[model samples]
Target: MRMMTCRLCGSDDLTGVVDLGATPPCERILTADQLDEPEVTYPLHLRVCTSCWLAQIPPLITPEETFTDYAYFSSYSASWVEHARAFVAGLDLRPDSFVVEVASNDGYLLRHVVERGVRCLGVEPSVNVGQAARERGVPTVTAFLTPESAQAVVAEHGKADYVVANNVYAHIPDVIGFTEGLRTLVADDGLVSVEVQHLLTLMQLNQYDTIYHEHFQYYTVASAQRALASGGLTLVDVELLTTHGGSIRLWAAPSGAPSQRVSDVLAMEKAAGLHDISGYIDFTERVAKVRRDLLSFLITAAEEGSTVVGYGAPGKGNTLLNHCGIRPDLLPYTVDRNPYKHGKFTPGARIPIFEPERIAADKPDYVLVLPWNLRDELIDQLSYIRDWGGRLVFPIPTLEVV
Candidate 1:
């Protein structure tokens, strides 16, 4: 495999941060029979550039290869849809603004934008999802958002007045090409809003599970600004969001574009230690502590003869479970609200997944909440479990009973 250059600064000055070794695709759950085959593993190593402060992995898979036959469905999570609705409604959107979204899964967000009288287009590689978005009246292009495709969009819809890319920046292997596409699609005065998981929070919270194959780059404000600048774009504003444990919602535009929020956000990140490399160097130790705490808690619970079951079959859940070497003995079954995943089993650990209704019937003493970031939401969703005196457990940042 070719070496990965710094996605932010385009420099080859990168050091090996960590290697998670090979593992199955985090979301690739299998049936009992399908589990007999060998699992596919991608390198989970991260490297940082001294000059740019960008943390990233090599682009092992292209968007066409990974997304054209995509399986992820955003509408599966009710909270995710609510989040989309809130984001669209909150923006100071103009009725005539042409909105474009990369990876617009099933038009969850774009539909909301359209409902408010904005013109919208979605660039999605996944055929199924792109078609779905189009079905919902969102003009969608069923192709990867590359420089060429971006030019086409510019020609057809005129330069987009607003480009919304949520959780899609890290999925691209050709970071330069993808950003170049953004440059073409975005009008000179238009803004690009990108939502990515914050690296500082990931390290602070020990969110190693977010370091999967799909997430090629783990972004910080400093890293993001550098990447955007390289493509002639500027980070004009940023907002720290609680979604996905922690995320940074960035607004960017061409360097000459005017936005009062730019310098303010840059100053804020500098104050928050975004420019310091030592902070990342010190984070590995904290990550190790989280691993130790989670293992100890799970081991103790198992020893105590507690009937442990898992709630939520998210990709992060698979990473944590596999990293901790958890098997069925520690957690017999996991429940998922998504019906698509309920009847399947987790990728590496093969933990059985059942519907939430099975929780009371099985009468598990403790339910390990896998989507710990949404503990509040999950707690409310599964509050009925408390009726049977069941307690919720979460393992990340710290292992604690809820």
Candidate 2:
């Protein structure tokens, strides 16, 4: 389903940025029984809105089909857990102040808020993670955060002092509705913090793998501010983060002046040509070069009789694999810390997934770090691979063996 209009401003003036070709749902890893069945693939093209400069993909698949049984669990990454803790610690919240996290998976972040005696509720759409959150003593509502859902939450739990939307902003197709819900759920002076992958970093670092069906939109500070303004919110402050390659944590309020950081970030984006259509013209070529570079490296490795396996089975990894058309012959298997992904095959690529210990047992010649965003942590964890003279490979930014 191609989008006829821009998701943020509903402008028909959309320009083609990059077409990653058709790809299976990024997180739709298959079991042995389901492997034989035909898998559906959707177009993974990105369009930049000329009016708002928002780079986005059409909502090809429904939210239910993509997220009802999510495979990506937040708590699996230890560094991410510590990042969440630090975020919670930075907030000055009273014990009675309510903090609501949209798309809070398995209570990873909210548990910190709960530990501080601050009231917290998580609006999670996936039943498995929602249940997991409940089990972890985090009150969770198993529903997508829409305007109606927001109203209901406000009625039950009162207006939230802080509405945290971390890394889930890009997954939503109904951008306006979700933002409007944020307006309704938050109090007049309450804060709404949204963290999303920065579009500048994606284009600058050639992070084309992040483009997928689940991520309906890619945001720059300018585009994000305009989208938030539609929901009666003002972009108050901005904080740049190194997570997910690079991301921007936006602090918005119903009524507040834009901070210096917000102005500076927006100025930087403007200076970088993100506000114009011409700025995105080179991205397609860059993405193609990345694909060629990776394939060349993998082919060279195969010719040298070196066995290569993947480190993580993340959604971004699936996109990278499918886009590069890598199969088991080049990269035999991948290991993941998340047990849910074990015993499953990556979507489209059909690479087998096993526990991280499998790398130790098999001792593959090279470990392809799939989730390149967490390369540091993965490198440290799998340092023993170096003991066996096994090198680590990173596909994004450039094909490099470290």
Candidate 3:
């Protein structure tokens, strides 16, 4: 294969981190009418820059194609909503503070900001979720973050005292441009907070399922510093979060002294060999083990004549299912809390989608959870499945039957 350019740095020296072959756009669930039509798939390979150590995939799909009419709504998960609420409550903001959140899906977090009587706005690219945010009293602007779009928001509402870009830093292919947009929207002295899945956790814990088309890149502290500096921001501090398997909540500003957490995390990354390409050596093997383990369990259940179903329709699940070649024969069908996916099928896997209630109704012997990151939340919600001697299967980190 030809060498690919690193989007974070202009490096042509990228080596494979792990390749899941190819998959359909994770979010592109198929309606019944479209099932017969040819579905498009792209390279789901994750590569790390030898120069900068930024893990990235090729920008084969654009943000517009995926985000303009998004299906994933933030409000669907109670744990995530509570996480957002607590995060908003923790910020030291007075009544006069203005806040902005990029990729603010359905205003799940901003609504809490609004409840605090602080002025807030959401920059969402998805029309459906943006409208949902507006309906909930979170003033939302439906547009992707470009420098010009950021300037327009700044011109109208004045600069934000705080800029929040949670779980979105990894979604953009144009790394510098998106960071510049964040910089433009923030005040000269304002702090910008970003939450992204930690690259270290992903590699060490075998969380390769997160490698999908929408997520264009991943970052180590060393690489993140370079990306932030390109857009005139500095990494001030870093907080390790348990959200999304593991994540880093980056606290940054126009300038500031590096915090102890930032230094500690950087040192940890270096010690783990993530400072260079050495840390990525065994990732593909680990990923293959996860695939083999999950497929073994599913095939065993199929031969034993035990029924199995899936728990969630998350994008990560789509990547896992498609890569493992799971189908309705093995999975039968999957369920999700989001009504938008009720009658649809997973993009490449073609497993039928239903409501969460379907698991209880069908009384399947086992339910394979898709969004294993929310294992605790799902366990409580699906506890009733225990009534029929049912079990939940988690495929990542390791295959476990709970």
> Candidate 1, after superposition: displacement of residue 83 in Å?
2.2
**Candidate 3 residues 99-190, lDDT tens each?**
99999999999999999999999999999999999999999999999999999999999999999999999999999999999999999889
Candidate 3: segments with Cα more than 4 A from true spot:
none
Alpha carbon deviation, residue 104, candidate 1 (Å): 0.4
The superposed Cα distance between candidate 1 and the true structure at residue 152, in angstroms, equals 1.6
TM accuracy, model 1 = 0.92
Residue 215 of candidate 2: its Cα lDDT? Answer: 96
Q: Candidate 3: give the clashing pairs.
A: none
lDDT of 2 by residue, 132-197 (tens): 999999999999989999999999989999999999989999988999999998999799999999
Q: lDDT of all the models against the reference?
A: 0.81, 0.93, 0.93
Q: Tens-digit lDDT track for model 1 on 1-402?
A: 576677666778887766666667777778778878877777677777877777887777655656776657787667888999998887777867888999998898998987888888998889977787888888888878888999988888899888899999888867778888998999888889899998868877778878877788888877787777767788878888888999989888886543456566566656656566555665566666767887777788789887889998888888778777788887889998777676789988899999988998888888889988887778888888888788988787777887
Per-model TM-score on C-alpha atoms:
0.92, 0.98, 0.99
What local lDDT does model 3 show for residue 143?
A: 94
RMSD of 1: 2.3
lDDT of 2 at 174: 90
lDDT value for candidate 2? 0.93
**Candidate 1 lowest-lDDT run of ten:** 256-265
